[model samples]
Target: MSERIPVFKPYIGVDTAKAAVDALDLGWLGMGSYVRDFEARLGSVLGVEGERVVAVNTGTSALHLAMLSLGIGPGDEVITPSFNNIGDFQAIRQAGAEPVFCDIDEETLGIDVEKAEALISPRTKALIGMDYAGIPCRLDALQEMAARHQLKVIHDAAHALGSRLHGRSMAAYGDITIFSFDPVKIITSIDGGALVVETATQVEALHRYRLLGMDQSARRMYTNERAWTYDVADRGFRYHLANLHASIGLSQLELLSAFIETRRDACRRYAALLAGVEGLRLPATDFTDVAPFIYYVRIAGGRRDDVIRSLSEAGIDTGIHWIPGHNFTLLKTCRRGDLSVTERVGREILTMPLHSFMPAST
Candidate 1:
């Protein structure tokens, strides 16, 4: 029997472990200097200012904070792809806004601009576009649509840490964008995320939203201090990233380029190895622009299930990218536009084993 190839895995080593130990040795583990330094490092990678970044405990928290920063709330509607992690929908709902599910582009596996445009109404406040499986959405087109409709754009770039589109950073688009550092994402901070803002104002708002609306808490924490006497101007959450998590993130960020190369090579390898496999269709590769988090293939002719079973027996693991959000019981009654692409993709897309640490032969 061979080793079981996981659908996703984190690349960790002595450096990462040492980072965690170093944080513990500091004797302070909350959202402090390490978190600030992580945000600064991430900002440098994004070619943005450190003040424009807000580190959070989870990618979902980043999404929720981004929405809240934009003042999206009850009676507001946010258009987003139905074929995405449930966290996307939950984030919108968590902001007291309604998620208006939209269809996805079959090629990009992201929100279809045409379908999203058709669903817009007077109540629409924003659009959330996820970079599904680390492939960036047609962001320029989406941005144009948002401008025309007066809607804010939030790029849910949870899987797009090292990805780009047309040589521009994935985080460089949209009004606000968030990246994930979860165990299964492009990089792991042992569970952390960060939101990128376009303006100093949104940065401040996000800083407050993630720290229980405690004004200046983020800035204070950056100096290894706290807001002992502060004002809570608005609603917020205790969603700030901790020093321990940031330590891991810093270690991982240092090795991000190498991780990107490995993942990119793995994706290309999969494309070559599975090129002639029947009933399997791989996405067109654009290594120059995409830093894929998962190498998913579209299985056709009803062989998806059988292929998964065979892979399982062969010590390989597989997963479905998602089930359409509209199909969920809780969201079944929610408003939705044409989900034709979302429905079809949901049935055919299978996430295969593709990770930074994966063996070349895998």
Candidate 2:
């Protein structure tokens, strides 16, 4: 490597800070017009005609809205991968549903479609497929399974803002797709996320659910602004992003194409650099339109910790993307059956720094 790398780097600029500054000076720091504009702009990126996308404060809220809108409440089981971030689990629980754990396949580092099948029960309501490190999930296969099981599909696209599969965005396939705009993503909205949903019913439900569940429309209020006469139709939260976050998001979204290209180039270079390294595995590319969001390499022979320690000592901080969600103390009691592969893969995986900020080197 030409230069030292950190665990993660946020792709950002002065323009983003200026946008937030302008919002601060204005005084209206609540969610309003900016969020709507961001939503409209983001919806356009879906590459799907008439795609209805909604922007929320965080990715968690987006998933929560997806579950809530689908009426997935207590006793409903949402089959999900235990190989990635646990944010989706909280969203499921918040929607009063249980998140059923499914193991990942070592070959693709994605949820084993067959393993997912075994976990399905009569109470299964939905399936949330996580696009681990920008690799688009096998949506076609998963969708087929979802349809057969009568379950809606939600995509945790937190690391897949600009990722694609077969020229289609992940959001284009899932019933509800959530994109996180956190600092370390390909693009940064400072701190924000968007939920690409379908149908007016789902959009309206998301809007209300994120904005206090209040009928704040002027038509429903005696005054020009929202009045005290409001109803909490569903369990809602103040998950609406401020104008500042939206402003920054707008700038970042415009720069997404370039960022994505850079990330792809980096992944190709990384894969080539370590092409013949033994005891290491490069990411699989079953999907043609693969768009990488992280620089991860799986260390075989259980030397993942050694690599991380070595990288850290060399000023190249590395990270393990996640631990199995079921391993968490909170969910330990709920874990059923054996999860050996999921347990081992959880430790063997390591992520190197990847973003658009680093200078291109030959």
Best by TM-score: 1
For all the candidates, what are their Cα RMSDs to the real structure? 1.2, 3.0
Give the alpha carbon lDDT tens digit for every residue of 231-301 in model 2.
77766688878778887888888888877777777777788788899998878863236556787888889
Give the per-residue lDDT digits (tens) of candidate 1, residues 298-317.
99888899989998999999
**Residue runs of model 2 more than 4 Å from their true location after superposition:** 1-4, 48-51, 218-229, 286-288
Candidate-wise lDDT, in order: 0.87, 0.76
Clashing pairs in 1: none
The TM-score of predicted model 1 comes to 0.97
Model 2 weakest lDDT span, ten residues long = 217-226
